[model samples]
Every structure is written in structure tokens, then in C-alpha cells.
Target: MDKQLLERVTQPLGHPSTSSSTTTGDTPGVNEPRRDYETGTGPSPQQRDAINQIFALLRYNYHNQFTKAFPDLEAVKTGKRLWLNLLAEYPADVLLKAAERAVKECTWLPNVHEIIVRCDLASSLGVPDSWNAYLEACRAPTPKREQRWSHPIVYLAGKASDWFFLANNIEEVAYPVYERNYAILLRRLLAGEALDLPMEKGLPDHVEHPLPRQEQQQRLRDLIADFDHPGRS
Candidate 1:
């Protein structure tokens, strides 16, 4: 919102503007110097300016970055993995749609993190990727076409532990959805959550579930359902 501060902050450090009409040379027009946001910060002015610069860069390069990174279906697919963990926080349809887009449009290949981030985001949104081995644990009777993270409370906790271990083994980190769900599990555990644990973790406390099992699924389902569908009970 503050224009002058933005200008001051955005002014290039070494390179001066090369505009023909403007003689200030300090200006940031067509050949003008680009601001350095990563340096100098004792006063709040620097931080505020940094925020402004971040917004500007985001605004100007938002779509462009995506465009450059995702030129074809492969790129989208490659990039899609980054969002995998992120997808766990949302609805299944939403995640599937995102996956579909990536699977369809990206030209460049993405890293495992990309797929995992989407999964994480999905989990954060309440959508998790379920393999047949995973979904069988959801309490979905028949294990429907679309796999969900958890169905019941007992197996869910155990499954979460399993998944967390798997994630660790895979060396995944910071994927929002998975992290969110994982946190949720811990919070409930700390609260002495009531439910079953299907896994064979041999947890000493009746409070915390160590491994994922069928009983854990039931407990997790019940616990999550209480929060997810408060009106159902």
C-alpha cells in the first residue's frame, strides 16, 4: 500500500536504471537495477519492504513460474508429486482433480517431494492417497475405487504410524497434509484419546498408539469423525 517505501526498497543496489527519458539513473524502469531483498535489515522498514517485494514478485511471476515449470503433461506429473502430502488435507475430488491436471499438462518431470507435497496438502485438506494396502485399513467395507486416509479410529492411528515411518524411510519432509494429519494424531494421543489400535506397536500407555492396526483404525475413525462430522453423532 505504501508506494514510496516500496520504491526505496525495490531500488537496485548496484545496477541503475537505463531509461532514456529519466536521468535519475537510480530509477528501476527498463534497464534499472533490481532490488535486493535478501540484504540489510536492522529497522522494520527493511522487513516491510521485503514483504512488498515478495508480493510484487509473486504477482508478476506467479503464473509465469508455473508456466515455465509446467510446459507439458510430464512436467505437471513431475510437479504434481510436490503437492502429494498437501493433498491429504482436502477432499478426494479436489486432490484427484489436481493430480489429473498434473498428470495431463506437465512436460518436465517432478521430484518425489512434489508428489508428496500434493499428498500432504491433500491430507491437510482431509484427502489422502490410499493404496489398496492402505485403503484396506480405512474401514471402507469394500475398499472403494477412491482410497481415503482413514475410516475408523482404531486402525487409523496405527496406520498413521505406519505411514509416518514410511514417510521417514522415504525421507519426505514438510508436506503439509501428512504433517497436519500426523499432528492431529499426536494431539489426540496426548489427550488420552479413546479408541482401539490395530497395529502391534506394544504401546505402554493405553493413551498413545504406536503402530497402525485395525483397532487403531476404529479409534482413529471415531476420533477424526467426531471432529470431521460433529453433527453425525
Candidate 2:
């Protein structure tokens, strides 16, 4: 979050852009986010540079508005530290992006929760909010593996919690299970892990055992009986 780390995060992941290549220019604004930060060692004292830059952007952009909100230098420092604590779990650069968006969108200086919400939005992207994610998992069509999910994390969470448990339980019981599973998946996502669902295994091209018709019927009956009283045998 410090200046050096901010510089590292702001740098393009690859070659410079054509405009930059064509002419010498000042570095991009400090508030510009490097999404690559998602893959970096998490927030530390150095990461405070990103937090500092966000405040700097707000102070400059919001002018007297930010000053009035903070009132004094001490207040500003306290506010920055408070934001860092509240938002430390997120990548520093993503928080900067959220700050940048707030500067654009807010008529007045936004609050810490507003900024945190933006960071969550940025982190989750296409994924729904936790409640909505739970609803999506609950309402997904049967043969759930074959259902088209908005994101694999949703399916992954539902699978981890057991689709039948989710379907049978009340939200008070089910939601926490889904939320916990979703949170684990969300962190994995933020850490840049792929969350693609596993493909459903299908029948082999040829049967390993060609049962006689009567035997196959008898086996089906036995399987249904076992399902009805799984503890029996």
C-alpha cells in the first residue's frame, strides 16, 4: 500500500501501451489499480501506500468537501487507518479502484462502508451477492450438475454444502452453510484460482457387464429398495 508497492501495482502486467511507447509522459495516476495485486502477497504496511493514494485522490478531488469531512490532519490519518483495517482483506489495488469509482460517482465524499461495498462489487464481478447466490443455488433446476450456473463458484458452493441439504433446510440453517462455502470459494477466486465446475461423468461407450433383461429388472428393484431404506443393506 505504500508508494513503491503502488508503483509496482500500477505498472502494466506486460508491455507499455502504444501511447506510452510513442511518447514520454508522466506515470499514470497513483489511484490507477493493478489487478495483478490480487496475486501478490497480501496487504501489509507497504500496502498502506495504496490506501494513502486513495486518500490523496479523495483529498485532491473532493477538495474542501473531504477536508470538512475529516476536519483535521489527525482526523485524516485516523480515517485512512480505519479504512485500511476495514478493507484490508481486499487487494490494495482493488480498493484503489473502488476509491477511484467513488470519486467519479459520489457528489459528496463517500463513507467507508460505501467504498467497501464497491470493493466487494469489484471482487465478485459477475457473481451475485451472498443472499442472491443462496437463492440461485436453491432455485437451480434439478440435474443440478447440468444446470447453467451464473458462475462455477455458485455451483461449487452448493455442491460443497450438499444440494439436498440446501433444498431441505430453512434459510436460517441453510444460508450459513452456503455462505461459508461461498466465502471459501470467493477467497479462492480473489486469489486467482479457477473455480470451474467438474464435468459430470457419463456412461461408458459400452457396458462392462451385459446383464440379462430379467437380471437388470431385478437389480433395479433392489436398488430402489436400498434407496428407500439405505440403512437396511
Candidate 3:
């Protein structure tokens, strides 16, 4: 392997590291700056690092295949750049997960499309994608146990992850938890485990009604009078 070539290809184009370490004297959690990847605008430093690591692993694991695929070192560099562009939209963790999948599943040097498809957690698995599942989890009507879920996995994940937390937190904080839970349940389902969603309880056989408007108003006045004079008849 040409270490020089690897260094050149993996180096960040121009952006400085956006790591928390770069922030001096700033309180750890109070007002930390948001990195590019947090808002999903572009590839973050972490994404860059993760992809670079993926390339390193691929080069090591598929040296002969990589040499055959790329005619020269320059071709290898071009291929890496192309991959960076193609995968820049994904989060760092997603990229790493996809690369891990490719390493395990592909018999040869996997193509960019293979990695991208792996990154797509929902479409590849035939389940509702994590993003849509997240929306469903967040926006489902209250009494969530009874709402019609897109998939049983979605409901199970949301319930396991805490419906209240999923509903209240921002996507950055909440989606990952939901996504992880969803993935775990998905794995179990794929392994033939049956996930039972909570059964919606039936309405009672009998129920009470509130008093009519006139009677309710009369009752309210009587209560007020009683409060004003406790012994009044």
C-alpha cells in the first residue's frame, strides 16, 4: 500500500476538525457548536474519518481486488473521492455500519452502490425506513398503544424507547435511540421472533355522562354559595 497516497486521499479537503476538542474554554454541554453533519448539510469531519477508515479496511482486506479494479494509484485516489461524494450525505455511524455490512457480505470489492444500499436501513430490509418510522413514532396520536402502527416493529420500538421521550426530544437526540431500538427489534423479527404489540383495551360495557349544561351551571352556583357560607341551607 502507498501510505503517501492513502494520506493524500483521506486528508480533509479544507475544513478544520469540528470536534469538541477544538472548542476551547467552552462549557461541555451548555452551548456547544453544531457540526455540519448534525444538521445534515454536508459530510462531517467524523463522516470523513469514518469513510477514510472504511477505505483503509477495504484496501487491506481486498488488496488484490482493489488493484484489479483500479489501474493505477491515481485511479484509486479518484475512486476514493467519488466514494466520498456519493456517501457524504450519510451520517458517520451509518457509513461505518454500511462498510461493516459490505465487509461481511460482499465476496469481492463492493461498489459504491452496495455500500449506499447497506446504509439505507429501511428499504433494503423491506421495512418502513427509520426516518418514516421516526415520524410515525413522534407524530402518532396519544394513547399511542392504540394507534395504527405502520409496522409492529415501529410500535414496539417506540414503546421500548419510551413514547414520551420520543415525542418530546429533537430528532438528533431522539431518532438515534428510536432507530437503534427499531433495528434491534427488526433483527429479532428477521430471526423469526414474534413481536407482540400491546393490545388496545376495549371500552367499558357501561359509562357515565356529565350533567347537562343547565344542571351543571346550577350545581356550580350551589357550590359557590356553600363556599361563601358553609352552614347555609
Q: Best candidate per TM-score, number?
A: 3
Q: Residue 83: error of model 2 in Å?
A: 10
- Models 1 onward score TM values of 0.19, 0.42, 0.52
* Residue 126 lDDT in candidate 1: 33
Cα distance off (Å), candidate 2, residue 166: 1.0
lDDT tens per residue, model 3, 18-124: 45423312223322233432344444455556766887778778877866786454565566557767886565556777788899999899999999998777345
Candidate 3 global TM-score = 0.52
Query: What is the lDDT of every predicted structure here?
Result: 0.37, 0.67, 0.69
Instruction: Order the candidate numbers by TM-score, best to worst.
Output: 3, 2, 1
Clash total of candidate 1: 91
**lDDT value for model 3:** 0.69
Q: Please say which candidate is ahead in lDDT: 2 or 3.
A: 3
Worst 10 residues of 2 by lDDT: 15-24
lDDT of 2 by residue, 37-126 (tens): 223222343346667778778767876677678665446645765676687666455566678888889998888888888788745667
Segments of candidate 2 deviating more than 4 angstroms: 1-124, 202-233
Model 2, 211: alpha-carbon shift in Å? 11
